[model samples]
Target: MANVTVVDHPLVQHKLSIMRNRETSTGGFRRLLREISLLLGYEVTRDLELTTMRIETPIEPMDAPTLEGKKLVFASVLRAGNGLLEGLLDLVPAARVAHVGLYRDHDTLQAVEYFFKAPTDLHDRLVIVVDPMLATANSAIMAIDKLKERGATNLRFLCLLAAPEGIKRFTEAHPDVPVFTAAIDRQLNELGYIIPGLGDAGDRMYGTK
Candidate 1:
Protein backbone atom coordinates (compact mmCIF):
# COMPACT_ATOMS: atom_id res chain seq x y z
CA MET A 1 0.00 0.00 0.00
CA ALA A 2 2.90 2.34 0.61
CA ASN A 3 3.82 2.77 -3.03
CA VAL A 4 0.67 1.66 -4.82
CA THR A 5 -1.46 4.13 -6.75
CA VAL A 6 -4.90 2.99 -7.83
CA VAL A 7 -6.21 4.91 -10.82
CA ASP A 8 -9.85 5.43 -9.85
CA HIS A 9 -10.90 7.86 -12.55
CA PRO A 10 -14.52 7.60 -13.63
CA LEU A 11 -13.62 6.71 -17.19
CA VAL A 12 -11.33 3.94 -16.00
CA GLN A 13 -13.98 2.46 -13.73
CA HIS A 14 -16.63 2.66 -16.47
CA LYS A 15 -14.42 0.98 -19.03
CA LEU A 16 -13.37 -1.73 -16.58
CA SER A 17 -16.99 -2.53 -15.81
CA ILE A 18 -17.71 -3.10 -19.48
CA MET A 19 -14.62 -5.24 -19.86
CA ARG A 20 -15.69 -7.46 -16.98
CA ASN A 21 -18.89 -8.52 -18.69
CA ARG A 22 -18.65 -12.00 -20.21
CA GLU A 23 -20.89 -10.84 -23.05
CA THR A 24 -18.26 -8.38 -24.25
CA SER A 25 -16.67 -9.53 -27.47
CA THR A 26 -12.95 -10.05 -27.83
CA GLY A 27 -12.65 -6.95 -29.98
CA GLY A 28 -14.55 -4.93 -27.40
CA PHE A 29 -12.42 -6.23 -24.56
CA ARG A 30 -9.21 -5.35 -26.40
CA ARG A 31 -10.48 -1.88 -27.26
CA LEU A 32 -11.58 -1.15 -23.70
CA LEU A 33 -8.22 -2.27 -22.32
CA ARG A 34 -6.38 0.09 -24.66
CA GLU A 35 -8.66 2.95 -23.63
CA ILE A 36 -8.40 2.25 -19.89
CA SER A 37 -4.65 1.89 -20.17
CA LEU A 38 -4.28 5.45 -21.45
CA LEU A 39 -6.01 6.68 -18.30
CA LEU A 40 -3.86 4.42 -16.20
CA GLY A 41 -0.77 5.52 -18.10
CA TYR A 42 -1.62 9.11 -17.25
CA GLU A 43 -1.47 8.39 -13.50
CA VAL A 44 1.56 6.11 -13.76
CA THR A 45 3.64 8.76 -15.49
CA ARG A 46 2.18 11.76 -13.67
CA ASP A 47 5.22 12.41 -11.55
CA LEU A 48 7.83 12.14 -14.29
CA GLU A 49 10.74 14.53 -14.05
CA LEU A 50 10.49 17.59 -16.25
CA THR A 51 13.03 20.23 -17.24
CA THR A 52 12.63 23.40 -19.22
CA MET A 53 14.33 24.17 -22.52
CA ARG A 54 14.41 27.48 -24.35
CA ILE A 55 12.40 27.24 -27.56
CA GLU A 56 11.22 29.72 -30.16
CA THR A 57 7.49 30.19 -30.61
CA PRO A 58 5.52 32.32 -33.03
CA ILE A 59 5.48 35.21 -30.59
CA GLU A 60 8.83 34.75 -28.82
CA PRO A 61 11.35 32.29 -27.42
CA MET A 62 10.46 30.81 -24.05
CA ASP A 63 11.36 27.95 -21.74
CA ALA A 64 9.14 24.95 -22.44
CA PRO A 65 8.94 21.89 -20.22
CA THR A 66 10.09 18.50 -21.48
CA LEU A 67 10.79 15.16 -19.90
CA GLU A 68 14.33 14.94 -18.52
CA GLY A 69 16.97 12.24 -18.97
CA LYS A 70 16.67 9.33 -21.38
CA LYS A 71 13.40 8.19 -22.91
CA LEU A 72 11.28 6.09 -20.56
CA VAL A 73 11.09 2.35 -21.09
CA PHE A 74 7.98 0.19 -21.11
CA ALA A 75 8.89 -3.38 -20.17
CA SER A 76 6.00 -5.52 -21.32
CA VAL A 77 5.64 -8.98 -19.83
CA LEU A 78 4.85 -11.22 -22.80
CA ARG A 79 1.54 -11.51 -24.68
CA ALA A 80 -0.92 -10.19 -22.12
CA GLY A 81 1.23 -7.22 -21.28
CA ASN A 82 1.05 -6.19 -24.91
CA GLY A 83 -2.62 -5.30 -24.43
CA LEU A 84 -1.68 -2.58 -21.95
CA LEU A 85 1.50 -1.73 -23.88
CA GLU A 86 -0.44 -0.52 -26.91
CA GLY A 87 -2.23 2.28 -25.06
CA LEU A 88 0.80 3.33 -23.07
CA LEU A 89 2.66 3.66 -26.36
CA ASP A 90 -0.19 5.81 -27.66
CA LEU A 91 0.31 7.97 -24.58
CA VAL A 92 4.09 8.25 -25.09
CA PRO A 93 5.01 7.09 -28.52
CA ALA A 94 8.67 7.98 -28.05
CA ALA A 95 9.08 5.64 -25.12
CA ARG A 96 11.37 2.67 -25.60
CA VAL A 97 9.99 -0.86 -25.46
CA ALA A 98 11.13 -4.10 -23.87
CA HIS A 99 9.59 -7.55 -24.02
CA VAL A 100 10.09 -10.22 -21.41
CA GLY A 101 8.63 -13.49 -22.59
CA LEU A 102 7.35 -15.49 -19.66
CA TYR A 103 4.47 -17.84 -18.99
CA ARG A 104 3.03 -19.26 -15.81
CA ASP A 105 3.57 -22.95 -15.24
CA HIS A 106 0.05 -23.93 -14.14
CA ASP A 107 1.03 -26.69 -11.77
CA THR A 108 3.57 -24.65 -9.84
CA LEU A 109 2.24 -21.23 -10.82
CA GLN A 110 5.87 -20.24 -11.27
CA ALA A 111 7.26 -18.05 -14.00
CA VAL A 112 9.57 -19.40 -16.69
CA GLU A 113 11.38 -16.95 -18.90
CA TYR A 114 11.92 -17.99 -22.48
CA PHE A 115 12.96 -14.74 -24.10
CA PHE A 116 14.08 -11.26 -23.15
CA LYS A 117 14.91 -8.24 -25.25
CA ALA A 118 15.42 -4.68 -24.05
CA PRO A 119 17.31 -1.49 -24.61
CA THR A 120 20.98 -1.65 -23.67
CA ASP A 121 20.86 1.53 -21.60
CA LEU A 122 18.32 0.36 -19.08
CA HIS A 123 20.27 1.82 -16.16
CA ASP A 124 19.87 5.29 -17.59
CA ARG A 125 16.11 5.25 -17.91
CA LEU A 126 12.97 4.70 -15.88
CA VAL A 127 11.35 1.33 -16.55
CA ILE A 128 7.64 0.72 -16.18
CA VAL A 129 6.64 -2.94 -16.33
CA VAL A 130 3.17 -3.68 -17.69
CA ASP A 131 0.92 -6.70 -17.34
CA PRO A 132 -2.85 -7.00 -17.65
CA MET A 133 -3.30 -9.00 -14.46
CA LEU A 134 -1.16 -9.48 -11.40
CA ALA A 135 -2.97 -12.51 -10.05
CA THR A 136 -0.05 -14.47 -8.69
CA ALA A 137 2.65 -11.82 -9.35
CA ASN A 138 5.06 -14.54 -10.46
CA SER A 139 5.64 -13.12 -13.89
CA ALA A 140 5.71 -9.56 -12.63
CA ILE A 141 8.27 -10.33 -9.95
CA MET A 142 10.52 -12.31 -12.28
CA ALA A 143 10.33 -9.66 -14.99
CA ILE A 144 11.39 -6.94 -12.58
CA ASP A 145 14.14 -9.13 -11.22
CA LYS A 146 15.54 -9.66 -14.71
CA LEU A 147 15.41 -5.95 -15.43
CA LYS A 148 17.21 -5.07 -12.22
CA GLU A 149 19.82 -7.64 -12.98
CA ARG A 150 20.44 -5.79 -16.21
CA GLY A 151 21.04 -2.55 -14.22
CA ALA A 152 17.59 -1.01 -14.01
CA THR A 153 17.21 0.83 -10.73
CA ASN A 154 14.22 3.13 -11.15
CA LEU A 155 11.19 1.01 -11.93
CA ARG A 156 7.43 0.73 -11.55
CA PHE A 157 4.86 -2.02 -12.07
CA LEU A 158 1.48 -1.37 -13.69
CA CYS A 159 -1.44 -3.74 -14.05
CA LEU A 160 -5.16 -3.62 -14.80
CA LEU A 161 -6.14 -5.75 -11.82
CA ALA A 162 -4.21 -7.19 -8.90
CA ALA A 163 -5.03 -9.70 -6.19
CA PRO A 164 -4.17 -9.10 -2.54
CA GLU A 165 -2.08 -12.23 -2.45
CA GLY A 166 -0.26 -11.17 -5.57
CA ILE A 167 0.31 -7.64 -4.29
CA LYS A 168 1.64 -8.91 -1.01
CA ARG A 169 4.13 -11.23 -2.66
CA PHE A 170 5.11 -8.62 -5.23
CA THR A 171 5.69 -5.81 -2.77
CA GLU A 172 7.57 -8.08 -0.44
CA ALA A 173 9.80 -9.23 -3.27
CA HIS A 174 10.46 -5.75 -4.64
CA PRO A 175 9.69 -3.02 -2.13
CA ASP A 176 11.52 -0.33 -4.03
CA VAL A 177 9.47 -0.75 -7.18
CA PRO A 178 6.20 1.19 -7.01
CA VAL A 179 2.95 -0.35 -8.25
CA PHE A 180 0.04 1.16 -10.17
CA THR A 181 -3.24 -0.57 -10.95
CA ALA A 182 -6.89 0.15 -11.61
CA ALA A 183 -8.17 -2.15 -8.85
CA ILE A 184 -7.02 -4.63 -6.20
CA ASP A 185 -9.35 -7.58 -6.07
CA ARG A 186 -10.29 -9.60 -2.97
CA GLN A 187 -7.98 -12.54 -3.42
CA LEU A 188 -6.48 -15.13 -5.74
CA ASN A 189 -8.37 -18.38 -6.22
CA GLU A 190 -6.77 -21.75 -5.51
CA LEU A 191 -5.81 -22.03 -9.16
CA GLY A 192 -4.01 -18.64 -9.00
CA TYR A 193 -6.60 -16.54 -10.78
CA ILE A 194 -7.90 -13.27 -9.45
CA ILE A 195 -11.39 -13.58 -7.99
CA PRO A 196 -13.92 -11.29 -9.68
CA GLY A 197 -11.22 -10.41 -12.16
CA LEU A 198 -11.96 -9.93 -15.84
CA GLY A 199 -10.80 -13.52 -16.32
CA ASP A 200 -7.60 -14.45 -18.20
CA ALA A 201 -6.64 -11.22 -19.87
CA GLY A 202 -4.64 -12.92 -22.61
CA ASP A 203 -7.53 -15.25 -23.32
CA ARG A 204 -10.10 -12.50 -23.37
CA MET A 205 -8.05 -10.05 -25.38
CA TYR A 206 -7.00 -12.55 -28.03
CA GLY A 207 -10.05 -14.90 -27.98
CA THR A 208 -7.89 -17.82 -26.97
CA LYS A 209 -9.17 -20.82 -25.01
Candidate 2:
Protein backbone atom coordinates (compact mmCIF):
# COMPACT_ATOMS: atom_id res chain seq x y z
CA MET A 1 0.00 0.00 0.00
CA ALA A 2 2.98 2.33 0.48
CA ASN A 3 3.43 2.69 -3.25
CA VAL A 4 -0.28 2.90 -4.03
CA THR A 5 -2.74 5.73 -3.44
CA VAL A 6 -6.49 5.16 -3.55
CA VAL A 7 -8.36 8.32 -4.42
CA ASP A 8 -11.53 8.28 -2.33
CA HIS A 9 -13.04 11.56 -3.34
CA PRO A 10 -16.85 11.40 -3.26
CA LEU A 11 -17.28 12.42 -6.88
CA VAL A 12 -14.71 9.89 -8.01
CA GLN A 13 -16.61 7.08 -6.28
CA HIS A 14 -20.00 8.20 -7.64
CA LYS A 15 -18.81 8.50 -11.22
CA LEU A 16 -16.97 5.18 -10.98
CA SER A 17 -20.14 3.49 -9.69
CA ILE A 18 -22.08 4.69 -12.69
CA MET A 19 -19.37 3.39 -14.98
CA ARG A 20 -19.64 -0.03 -13.37
CA ASN A 21 -23.29 -0.49 -14.16
CA ARG A 22 -23.80 -3.09 -16.88
CA GLU A 23 -26.36 -0.94 -18.67
CA THR A 24 -24.31 2.24 -18.92
CA SER A 25 -24.01 3.32 -22.55
CA THR A 26 -20.71 3.88 -24.31
CA GLY A 27 -21.25 7.61 -24.43
CA GLY A 28 -22.06 7.68 -20.72
CA PHE A 29 -19.06 5.57 -19.75
CA ARG A 30 -16.67 7.77 -21.65
CA ARG A 31 -18.20 10.95 -20.32
CA LEU A 32 -17.86 9.72 -16.76
CA LEU A 33 -14.27 8.58 -17.30
CA ARG A 34 -13.30 12.02 -18.53
CA GLU A 35 -15.08 13.64 -15.61
CA ILE A 36 -13.59 11.43 -12.89
CA SER A 37 -10.11 11.74 -14.33
CA LEU A 38 -10.03 15.41 -13.39
CA LEU A 39 -10.67 14.56 -9.76
CA LEU A 40 -7.96 11.90 -9.81
CA GLY A 41 -5.59 14.33 -11.45
CA TYR A 42 -5.92 16.54 -8.44
CA GLU A 43 -4.32 13.94 -6.19
CA VAL A 44 -1.79 12.64 -8.71
CA THR A 45 -0.31 16.07 -9.29
CA ARG A 46 -0.63 17.33 -5.75
CA ASP A 47 3.09 17.34 -5.16
CA LEU A 48 4.24 19.09 -8.32
CA GLU A 49 7.13 21.33 -7.41
CA LEU A 50 6.62 25.08 -7.55
CA THR A 51 9.02 27.99 -7.52
CA THR A 52 8.52 31.70 -7.03
CA MET A 53 8.40 33.88 -10.12
CA ARG A 54 8.24 37.62 -10.60
CA ILE A 55 4.67 38.64 -11.35
CA GLU A 56 2.55 41.76 -11.67
CA THR A 57 -0.74 41.98 -9.85
CA PRO A 58 -3.49 44.55 -10.35
CA ILE A 59 -2.40 46.30 -7.16
CA GLU A 60 1.40 45.70 -7.22
CA PRO A 61 4.23 43.41 -8.28
CA MET A 62 4.62 40.05 -6.53
CA ASP A 63 6.56 36.82 -6.71
CA ALA A 64 4.09 34.17 -7.72
CA PRO A 65 4.52 30.43 -7.57
CA THR A 66 4.75 28.52 -10.82
CA LEU A 67 5.45 24.92 -11.76
CA GLU A 68 9.16 24.07 -11.82
CA GLY A 69 10.99 21.67 -14.10
CA LYS A 70 10.31 20.21 -17.53
CA LYS A 71 6.84 20.12 -19.09
CA LEU A 72 4.79 17.30 -17.59
CA VAL A 73 4.20 14.31 -19.84
CA PHE A 74 1.05 12.22 -19.87
CA ALA A 75 1.85 8.85 -21.39
CA SER A 76 -1.32 6.99 -22.23
CA VAL A 77 -1.41 3.24 -22.73
CA LEU A 78 -3.27 3.34 -26.03
CA ARG A 79 -7.07 3.20 -26.30
CA ALA A 80 -8.33 2.81 -22.75
CA GLY A 81 -5.73 5.17 -21.42
CA ASN A 82 -6.93 7.78 -23.86
CA GLY A 83 -10.24 8.06 -21.98
CA LEU A 84 -8.45 9.00 -18.76
CA LEU A 85 -6.01 11.27 -20.60
CA GLU A 86 -8.78 13.54 -21.88
CA GLY A 87 -9.65 15.07 -18.52
CA LEU A 88 -6.06 15.39 -17.33
CA LEU A 89 -5.26 17.26 -20.53
CA ASP A 90 -8.11 19.63 -19.84
CA LEU A 91 -6.60 20.29 -16.43
CA VAL A 92 -3.15 21.02 -17.87
CA PRO A 93 -3.29 22.16 -21.47
CA ALA A 94 0.44 22.91 -21.53
CA ALA A 95 1.44 19.37 -20.62
CA ARG A 96 2.97 17.12 -23.27
CA VAL A 97 1.33 13.86 -24.34
CA ALA A 98 2.59 10.42 -25.32
CA HIS A 99 0.93 7.26 -26.57
CA VAL A 100 2.15 3.73 -26.00
CA GLY A 101 0.11 1.18 -27.88
CA LEU A 102 0.18 -2.38 -26.63
CA TYR A 103 -1.93 -5.49 -27.13
CA ARG A 104 -2.08 -8.65 -25.06
CA ASP A 105 -0.93 -11.88 -26.60
CA HIS A 106 -3.79 -14.33 -26.07
CA ASP A 107 -1.74 -17.44 -25.53
CA THR A 108 0.76 -16.07 -23.04
CA LEU A 109 -1.25 -13.14 -21.69
CA GLN A 110 1.83 -11.01 -22.30
CA ALA A 111 1.93 -7.47 -23.61
CA VAL A 112 3.26 -6.59 -27.06
CA GLU A 113 3.95 -3.04 -28.13
CA TYR A 114 2.86 -1.97 -31.59
CA PHE A 115 3.41 1.78 -31.29
CA PHE A 116 5.40 4.18 -29.13
CA LYS A 117 5.78 7.89 -29.59
CA ALA A 118 6.78 10.25 -26.80
CA PRO A 119 8.37 13.56 -26.12
CA THR A 120 12.14 13.77 -26.64
CA ASP A 121 12.78 15.31 -23.22
CA LEU A 122 11.47 12.40 -21.19
CA HIS A 123 14.55 12.44 -18.97
CA ASP A 124 13.84 15.96 -17.82
CA ARG A 125 10.08 15.65 -17.45
CA LEU A 126 7.84 14.15 -14.85
CA VAL A 127 5.92 11.43 -16.68
CA ILE A 128 2.52 10.24 -15.55
CA VAL A 129 1.28 7.01 -17.11
CA VAL A 130 -2.46 6.52 -17.48
CA ASP A 131 -4.60 3.47 -18.10
CA PRO A 132 -8.23 3.01 -17.12
CA MET A 133 -7.71 -0.44 -15.66
CA LEU A 134 -4.68 -2.08 -14.05
CA ALA A 135 -5.95 -5.64 -14.15
CA THR A 136 -3.17 -7.98 -15.18
CA ALA A 137 -0.70 -5.03 -15.39
CA ASN A 138 1.20 -6.57 -18.31
CA SER A 139 0.53 -3.54 -20.46
CA ALA A 140 1.46 -1.09 -17.72
CA ILE A 141 4.63 -2.99 -16.82
CA MET A 142 5.85 -3.16 -20.38
CA ALA A 143 4.83 0.43 -21.01
CA ILE A 144 6.90 1.60 -18.04
CA ASP A 145 9.81 -0.56 -19.13
CA LYS A 146 9.79 1.12 -22.51
CA LEU A 147 9.50 4.56 -20.97
CA LYS A 148 12.54 3.90 -18.79
CA GLU A 149 14.49 2.67 -21.79
CA ARG A 150 13.76 6.01 -23.38
CA GLY A 151 15.20 7.94 -20.38
CA ALA A 152 12.20 8.65 -18.18
CA THR A 153 13.04 8.80 -14.48
CA ASN A 154 10.53 10.81 -12.48
CA LEU A 155 7.28 8.92 -12.97
CA ARG A 156 3.86 8.15 -11.55
CA PHE A 157 0.92 5.98 -12.65
CA LEU A 158 -2.78 6.82 -12.75
CA CYS A 159 -5.72 4.48 -13.25
CA LEU A 160 -9.45 4.36 -12.64
CA LEU A 161 -9.39 0.90 -11.08
CA ALA A 162 -6.85 -1.71 -10.01
CA ALA A 163 -6.77 -5.34 -9.03
CA PRO A 164 -4.84 -6.56 -6.00
CA GLU A 165 -2.84 -8.93 -8.11
CA GLY A 166 -1.99 -6.24 -10.58
CA ILE A 167 -0.90 -3.84 -7.88
CA LYS A 168 1.30 -6.48 -6.32
CA ARG A 169 3.05 -7.21 -9.56
CA PHE A 170 3.36 -3.57 -10.52
CA THR A 171 4.88 -2.44 -7.23
CA GLU A 172 7.29 -5.35 -7.20
CA ALA A 173 8.39 -4.58 -10.73
CA HIS A 174 8.83 -0.84 -10.10
CA PRO A 175 8.73 0.23 -6.49
CA ASP A 176 10.03 3.66 -7.31
CA VAL A 177 6.90 4.53 -9.30
CA PRO A 178 3.88 5.60 -7.28
CA VAL A 179 0.38 4.52 -8.30
CA PHE A 180 -2.85 6.52 -8.03
CA THR A 181 -6.27 5.00 -8.67
CA ALA A 182 -9.85 5.88 -7.91
CA ALA A 183 -10.67 2.39 -6.76
CA ILE A 184 -9.12 -0.99 -5.96
CA ASP A 185 -11.61 -3.66 -6.84
CA ARG A 186 -11.65 -7.32 -5.76
CA GLN A 187 -9.25 -9.90 -7.05
CA LEU A 188 -8.92 -10.64 -10.73
CA ASN A 189 -11.01 -13.49 -12.12
CA GLU A 190 -9.75 -16.61 -13.87
CA LEU A 191 -9.98 -14.93 -17.25
CA GLY A 192 -7.85 -11.98 -16.05
CA TYR A 193 -10.65 -9.47 -15.56
CA ILE A 194 -11.04 -7.39 -12.42
CA ILE A 195 -13.88 -8.69 -10.29
CA PRO A 196 -16.72 -6.19 -10.00
CA GLY A 197 -14.92 -4.02 -12.52
CA LEU A 198 -16.58 -1.85 -15.12
CA GLY A 199 -16.07 -4.59 -17.71
CA ASP A 200 -13.62 -4.14 -20.57
CA ALA A 201 -12.80 -0.43 -20.47
CA GLY A 202 -11.72 -0.18 -24.11
CA ASP A 203 -14.82 -2.00 -25.35
CA ARG A 204 -17.13 0.02 -23.17
CA MET A 205 -15.56 3.34 -24.04
CA TYR A 206 -15.40 2.68 -27.78
CA GLY A 207 -18.33 0.27 -28.13
CA THR A 208 -15.98 -2.14 -29.85
CA LYS A 209 -17.15 -5.23 -27.95
Candidate 1 runs further than 4 Å off: none
List, residue by residue over 133-178, the lDDT tens digit for candidate 1.
Answer: 9998999999999999999999999999999888999999999999
Predicted structure 2: lDDT: 0.95
Candidate 1 structure lDDT: 0.95
TM-score of each: 0.98, 0.98
Name the lDDT value of residue 6 in candidate 2. 98
> Could you tell me how far off, in angstroms, the CA of residue 167 lies in candidate 1 after the best superposition?
0.5
TM match of model 1 to true structure: 0.98
117 in model 2: Cα distance from truth in Å? Answer: 0.3
Instruction: State residue 90's C-alpha deviation in candidate 2, in Å.
Output: 0.1
C-alpha root-mean-square deviation, candidate 1 = 0.7
Query: What's model 1's lDDT at 167?
Result: 91
* Candidate 2, position 106, lDDT: 67
